[model samples]
Target: MSLFLGTHQNRLDVKGRVSVPASFRSALRKEQTKENHSLIFRPSHKMPCIEVWPLSIFSELTNSLDSLNLFSEEHDDIATTLYAEAWPIDPDREGRILLPDILKEHANLTDSVTFMGLGTIFQIWEPIAAIERCKAARHKVQQKTLAVPPKATKKGVEL
Candidate 1:
């Protein structure tokens, strides 16, 4: 129903290509109004992973950036960094995308890579790296006493 909802593992071929997951491919197809279904692949600013976003999402980001005061230091910094790291990607006929050297180096990806779903965007992670991150996150959550809000009914009463 939505884009990038699950984890998938795929291998990079000798030519540095890896297949996009089938569900992700189908999602991309729906967004297709032109000949090519393209994406922006870049290094994750927060992690050692590749961040993948549709062109439309990047367009929306640019639109939001346009609304920002051009002279603002934060805007200038983000605009510079985002545009510098992103790459426009097109998958081949076989639904494989060629990973660039910089991105691969950043993620430490060799033969195997894991695609992790994040609703609007997805991440390419080394499988072991992904596993370690997941474990660490779970452990961190377990150490915290997070409060859960009570469920609400239509009448706004807690249930």
Candidate 2:
């Protein structure tokens, strides 16, 4: 699997289009979808950021719903949460995707956006908010004294 890594910042144009990082585009291309430029944009459930997922990954992500009882409220809630916010997108030849007004508003996006790589996924954040989130994450780590877990050996657990 191609993992998205590093931080990239891009300018949002008047028409709400932003260029995806070259590295990210390369990573996404490796997914080998039928439509090369196809992508999906959705507001992140956690932070004030938009998430970019290739169609293949997005389809696989929805597979988890299979384990849920079809008639349950929990299933309905999760479905609504995921499907309701999803928007299909296609990057133009310049490797730019249009940030729809709804998602842009949800992420509180400004003139510039920060793409924070999260391994199998990536997030688009407002530059200031991304910086603030980083600071808070670091502070949270420093505030906690975490106990390290035992490492797993090839044959068994290791302390």
Candidate 3:
């Protein structure tokens, strides 16, 4: 997998379209198998940012839904949560996507937007908020509050 790794800042155009960083576009190009190149955008449940997922990654994410009981409330709720606010977006020829109004409002995005790479997924955040988030993440690391998990064995048990 081509991991998204870096921070990029771009201006949102008057039409609310923002150009995706070239590296991210390339990563998506490598991952997409379908003719229509697209991404999934949604308001992150836990954060004040827009979650950006390449189509393939989004599919893999939703696959977890298969584990839930069919037609059960738990399954319905999860499915609704995942699909309700999610929007599929195709970048224009210039590699720009029109930000949905809801997502823009959720992230408090104004003129400038920051694109943050988080390996499997990326996030669109307001520039200042992105900087603060980065600072907080660094602090957590310094405080030893976050660490890599143990590697999993073939049996799927952590070692």
Candidate number with greatest TM-score: 3
Candidate 3 ranges beyond 4 A from true positions: 150-159
Query: Which residue pairs collide, candidate 1?
Result: none
lDDT of 1 by residue, 1-159 (tens): 257788899999999999999998888888876854579998988999999988887777778788778999989998887889899998889899999999999999999999998877899999999999888877887889545556746336557
Q: Compute the lDDT for candidate 2.
A: 0.87
Question: Tens digit of lDDT per residue, candidate 2, span 41-104?
Answer: 8998888889988777787889989999999999999999899989989889899989889999
**Backbone steric clashes in candidate 1, count:** 0
Clashes of each: 0, 0, 0
Full-model lDDT for every candidate:
0.87, 0.87, 0.91
Instruction: Point to the candidate with the largest lDDT.
Output: 3
Comparing 2 with 3 on TM-score, the higher-scoring candidate is 3
* Off by more than 4 A, model 2: 35-37, 145-159
Tell me how far candidate 3 lies from the true structure as C-alpha RMSD in angstroms.
2.4
Distance from true location, Cα of 94 in model 2, Å: 0.8
For candidate 1, the TM-score is: 0.84
The TM-score that candidate 3 achieves is 0.90
